[model samples]
Target: MSLKTALRVIAWLLLAGLIFVTLSPIDLRPVSPAPVQLERAAALALIGFVFALAYPRHIWLVALVVLGSTVLLELLQLLSPSRHGRLIDVAVKLTGGGIGIAAGWLLWRWRPQR
Candidate 1:
């Protein structure tokens, strides 16, 4: 498969993992070295980076997906007895996503010209 296609697949996989992690019971989640908000930010940032690479021409769409997913996942968390949605987490996620998007743009720009 072309590199772009492979990257897209990887990006989707990452997204699926993110969803699973986001909705999982708090007690069942793996221990992290950082606070929950920081962890969430880091995960979303990585997600945004992969997605941006997968859709370089659609940066806005990538942004929407990252931010939208952040909100969607947090909302879904409301249904989990062990998880509660928080607006602060969403803000952190957005900040991380923006950072990732910027990184992706830089990567795309740095690619060798055909």
Candidate 2:
């Protein structure tokens, strides 16, 4: 598969995984060696980075979608008995995703045009 296609697949998979983990029972959530907040940030950041790379020409749209997704995912936690959404969590996720998006945008800018 082309790079863009591969990235798109990865991005979507990440999003699906996020949905599963966010909405599933607390016991079903994955454990990470990193701090909880860091793990959350890294996951969203990776999602944002892959998305930005996959659709470099639509970075702005991708940013909006990913950022929105971050908040929406957090908010969805409210529906789960074991999960609760918080503004601080959303803020952290947005920060991470923004950082990743900016990094991806810079990399795309630095690449030599074909």
Candidate 3:
């Protein structure tokens, strides 16, 4: 597979993992709830870099995917049996995604064009 194809696969896997973490039941007893959740949101945002790199020609799609997935995951959280969804978490996810997009754009700008 080409490098771009590999990156795309990695991006999809990360997205799937994000979905699983958001929707499935997991033990949350060991970590501080707020920080752990925040970290996940931030990491999700950073993961956007993979999409941005894998699809530089589709930056808007990358942004849409990041933001849309974040919203979707937040909505899914409402169905969690042991957890409640919060607006702040949604905001944090958005913030992280937006920052990640900006970071990706900057990186793309600096990368030597093919």
Candidate 4:
């Protein structure tokens, strides 16, 4: 019901989506007009942004979790014969997460304090 709770729920949902899309078969993946790299980056960025909003005081931890999750998920792809993990993809995802964190921090900072 509170803003913090809402943000946390959103972040969790986004993470769930990332896990699903990353681990699911290619045929089960969501369709998007954007390129695969862009989609991956944007998804992680959104998750990072929501996480930043949810825990503004733990930005470092947020970055760690986001980046770590990205790497771990990509690596997990190796378990699926249809999926291949790539370093370049992880690079894009990390960059996007950093950008999202910065943006979210800025927005949170500018919000009117209670």
Q: Candidate 4: what lDDT?
A: 0.89
Off by over 4 Å in 3: 28-34
Assess each prediction's global lDDT (C-alpha) against the native: 0.88, 0.90, 0.79, 0.89
Q: What alpha-carbon RMSD in Å does predicted model 1 have with respect to the real structure?
A: 1.3
Model 2 has an lDDT value of 0.90
Q: Which 10-residue span in candidate 1 carries the lowest summed lDDT?
A: 28-37
Model 2 alpha-carbon miss at residue 94, Å: 0.5
lDDT of candidate 3 over 5-98, digit per residue (tens): 9988988998887777677775743355568657866776777878888887889999999889888888877888876678888888888887
Model 2 TM: 0.95
lDDT of 1 by residue, 18-83 (tens): 888889988777777799778877888898998889999999998888889889998999999999
Error of 2 at 102 (Å): 0.9
**Poorest stretch of ten by lDDT in candidate 3:** 25-34
TM-score of 4: 0.94
In order of listing, the candidates' clash counts read 0, 0, 0, 0
Question: Candidate 1: which pairs clash?
Answer: none
Which 10 residues in a row give candidate 2 its minimum summed lDDT? 100-109
Model 2 segments more than 4 A misplaced: none
Ranking of all candidate structures by their TM-score, best first: 2, 4, 1, 3
Off by over 4 Å in 1: none
How much does candidate 1 score in TM-score? 0.91
